[model samples]
Target: MARKVGIYTRISRDDEGESLGVARQREDCERLADLRNWQAVKVYEDNDVSAFKRNVRREEFELMLTDLRAGLIDGIVAYDLDRLARKPQDLERLIEIYDDRPRLEFATVTNDVNLGTADGRTMARVMVAFANKSSHDTSRRLKRKHLELAQQGKASGGPAPYGWQKGDPEKVDQEAARHIKEAQKELLAGVRIGTIRTRWQEQGLGNPREGTKRMAHHRVTHILTNPRLVGYRTYHGEILYGEDGSPVMGDWETINTVEEWEAVCAVVAERQKSQPGRSLARTYLLSGIARCGLCKSKIRGQTNHKWQPGSKGARYKYQCSKVNGGCGKVARVGEPVDELIAQLALEEQRDRAASADVSPERRWPREQELNDLNTDIAQLIEAEKNKSISVSTLLQVLPEKERQRDELKLDRARFYKEQKQAEAKDDAVDLSLEEFFDLPIERQREIVLHSLSAVFIHPSGRGKRVFDPDLIEPVWRE
Candidate 1:
């Protein structure tokens, strides 16, 4: 009786409507079964699958193994041993299945094998070992090529980043590019990343990878912190440096100036270290800004969780956070002390509103100039690419243009600050003292820190839990 054989075929990458390679492999295996007078039971195929990828699921491959163990097929016929599996461990599994059935047969388009014989099993093992070695060699070569391309300042194969299109990093998307620049300025100006992220998501700003809206906060931070924005290449999270210790310039177009990128990174690192758990939570308005008048130590927010009659589950307060014995200074009620600070901030704003206009007009001309500067830089890079100008000309003129742009950015930031101050002055007059606390905690913190340089609470002797107005001194900003 003829043995039942299963024909298996696979292709690593099968482009749409282009799977002739795997089709041909299947045809060859079926023809071999016909010549040997064996019944071709079924065909199992794993399209667009790599045998070398251990984690990638090959459903048909698994099904074939299942059928083989059920005695549904006497053997598997493929174009080659490598097509069966490129990993030695995977091949060992097939060998083990064949060993369980002494009558099982295995064949390739080029060779026939008997699992019942020792020589056939030994040759099968040797073939799999060679296939595994070939897989490793191919991986090593690809990695070496990737590093070489990176050294040459080219984008190694992946989806292009925001503000850029695949294989053309020189031409940037203006709308997306503007967002990147804005994020850098915001981070440097003390706007929290979560705030920026929320605003961007609300404004319908998003990258290609994350869609047209609702991006994660870390994605926003990633764009701001990327070394690639400054025209440098990074390998495994470390910037690739030249022998002189300067960053190696990449072939891709630059976004922020190198100085601006470094400054953003420094600010982010500093904030991360200073703010402990729940850094971005913004639960306390004055946690990092207030100080203990007695010990001159930072007053941090504390929560007491003891449940008493008519008491809330968690009671919040501001206490002296001295490591070596606190001066026993604490604000028993957070609401009253917070209210007092809010009232003081509003009073200062009312006074400032009397003198300064604080309503600086938006510098549209400066913004236009910034847009023009980007055009000029792009033109310079294009000229260099076309061999119309030397790279020396690019390296020279680009920095000056970048410097001008950075200066204009600083001016724009100042205008924004003045604008916010003017708006706060209006809010102070319109909203009641209680309504001011109802604002987002971030906005409340911004207004308080903007108006006051320091808020110090002194101890008012023993058994005095009451917040004495005379003991609290706020140093208003000049």
Candidate 2:
């Protein structure tokens, strides 16, 4: 009997077009498996995906774990540890599988020179951390490059933003230019912003996609507010670091005369001052979760108007002191706002529970398949040790075994995580929006804050609030 082994390979988006073809990875793993006399159980491949965000997206990798836990494979092989995961958190999880399971082992072609040594494990972890940081740094560098291109009036990468097409050297989007002029004229005439958006859609102007197209209100607002339309560029919310380790506004480039872009700014300012009150804001139970949205700082509760006649009985509100002291904005009362939010949250909770039911049997792997694969991998490892395989032979075979082990471990972790989450879902809670509205204000507030993530409130007294849907959205257990 041969050792039941699994192989895993991953190629990031940057590696996809380069020399790191999936076939090359498979070939390397296969040649190694042959030398170790291990049976190739399966090969798990995730292509054009980033390892940094692997935990969130890799479903195939999760399935491999189910196979592993059921004893489908004895070990996993991978080209390298980073190929399994770039993030330290996720790498630590891989280490946990070996630490927790006595029958299991993890091997990497490049890094597992000695699995029995503490120093080897430490080196592997350090390498993973470096890889994770590199991925993050690369993302930041890419964003900077885009900003630089935008400043130079070049296309800022993705899908040409409604008015432009690819391969136009001059970057002159004639169609977008026409729409911008029309929108500018409407703004100058003091036409209602929403009406302008409707008109654009009716006339099939500036629709990014085809077929019964309608311009979104937000899209219209963005176009009317863009200084770029007037040949002037404004880097909205550009991140800049100040000298004292604080962030501040940086340099502005004069892409067009201020006078030329005056109409666009005026329209934006007017719209900002007159937006409608948001019902969604009132609906979310938890308006402030971690920090004050306005001040970007933690919110604190303090009693106010305590000495006043009836006002003394009022509860404390959540506000940002930084804003209240002229550094930020006014504090918002948490009680009524939280009450309204709770009502909305309950409705979402009910819906989520209704969607979360799934058959448990379908979620796990077949017992027989798992046992067979485990048996095969065990045999392979036994043969390697008995033959006292040469260093060259071990190097060739180890990676495939490591990949298989890692894949199974990932699958098992995902299964357990999902099971835990599913079990945690509250199905008994009846949370319809109407039902929520009927609940007492305090109960409503309790549900909202507990269920909702965040609520974005508009500055205007009449402005609407945006709710974080996760709190109320029902979990669909499948």
Candidate 3:
């Protein structure tokens, strides 16, 4: 009786999006099965996947093994032994399976294999070892070549970044670059990065790396945070620094300054420390902004769990509780107070234009100091590299300088965010007042943070259930 055979085929890449190469392999394997007088039961193919790379999943290969173990196929046919596996562990599994069934047969279109015999298994193992060696050597060479290209600030041949023209690192796409800058500004101004991502998707602002397929939340953050936007070469998410301890600037026309990049990175890092998706669960309009009038602690918004389905009571309220280090003295209903606070903030914006209290020329006074600190640090590293300073001295000085630089970077980031918020508040007032309620909670809170400094909720008398707007005191910013 003819043995039932399963044909296996694989190709590392299907550039044309069609499995034509694997299809040819399948034909050849089926022909081999016919020559051996075996009935071809099924064909398993893994396309655009590497056999050598252990990380790459060979789904069809695994399924064929399952069928082999089930005795559904008494024979296996492939184009070559190497196509079966370049990894030794994979070969051992097949050999073990073959040992379980003495009648099982394995053959290839390119080579005759009798896996029931020890000699055939040894030969197959030797061939796969050589194949594994070849893949390792190729991987090493490619990694070296990639490092060399990155050192020279050249693309290592992939999809272009979102802000740059495709396949051209030196040229900047002005419109795309503008969007990146806007993303940075929006992120620092307290707009959620997810919101920016959705906006970009709606606007069709995609690139080969970003918008072409999908713009996930992490990918959107990557575009905003990558140092490449400021004309620096990066590899595997790390900026490559030169021997002088400075970043290797790329050939691209820069979209943002170093200061802006530093600031945005600081903001991203700070946000990462808190629950990143907390904004999505935000229930109250003025949770963190509302304070306890007695103890001066931020009030949190909470749902009144005491009210069941049929109960008539406040569903949510802002409370200053002792558990969170508040005096446990103030509580008020959520919706009416939220509406009044927002209204008061809007009135503050309409009554007076935003004032810097100083001219634009006087802003950012510490920029020069920041530059000088960087210059001094770079000079020290260069001095140490030239043997002008000893390693001991270099290490001693660099830590403190680095600390100061990091602290200054943080201070600058905060100042920039504050200034941007003030500017955003001006823009907020420019919008129709009716639109404020339509914004996301985070945006509304951000606008209120700039327009009004604080909302002091004075305690309502005990048993006073009526909603009172007079008890809420809003301190508008000067």
Give the per-residue lDDT digits (tens) of candidate 2, residues 1-478. 8888788888775321343666687788887777778887899877666767545676556666667667788677788878887877766665666565655656667755333346766887888888888889987898788677655545454344444444442354676666775555445433456656666777777654443456667777776555444344335434332222122322222222333345356445545667754221222234335344454554455566564766634466655566444234645655555555555556566676678765553443643444455555566565666886665675686567657655764555445434432332332265566665554333444454445545543233345643333322221213
Q: Which residue runs of candidate 1 sit more than 4 Å off their true CA positions?
A: 1-85, 90-124, 166-169, 175-179, 189-222, 235-238, 241-246, 268-282, 288-453, 456-473
In candidate 2, residue 271 scores what lDDT? 52
Q: Rank the candidates by TM-score, best first.
A: 3, 1, 2
Q: Write the per-residue lDDT of candidate 1 for residues 196-312, one digit (tens) a residue.
A: 787777776655232244577678888888888888887767778553334678887777765466667766766787884455656877786777877777777777766465875
Runs with alpha carbons beyond 4 Å of true place in candidate 3 = 1-60, 71-80, 102-116, 165-179, 192-217, 274-280, 288-339, 354-426, 453-478
CA error at residue 301 for candidate 3, angstroms: 5.7
Which scores better on TM-score, 1 or 3?
3
What is the Cα-based lDDT of residue 191 in candidate 3? 77
The per-model lDDT (C-alpha) reads 0.74, 0.56, 0.81
**Best candidate, TM-score:** 3
lDDT of 1: 0.74
Model 2, residue 219: displacement in angstroms? 10
- List TM-score per model, in order: 0.49, 0.36, 0.72
| Clashing residue pairs found in predicted model 1 | 153-251
Q: Please count the clashing residue pairs in each candidate, in the order shown.
A: 1, 55, 1
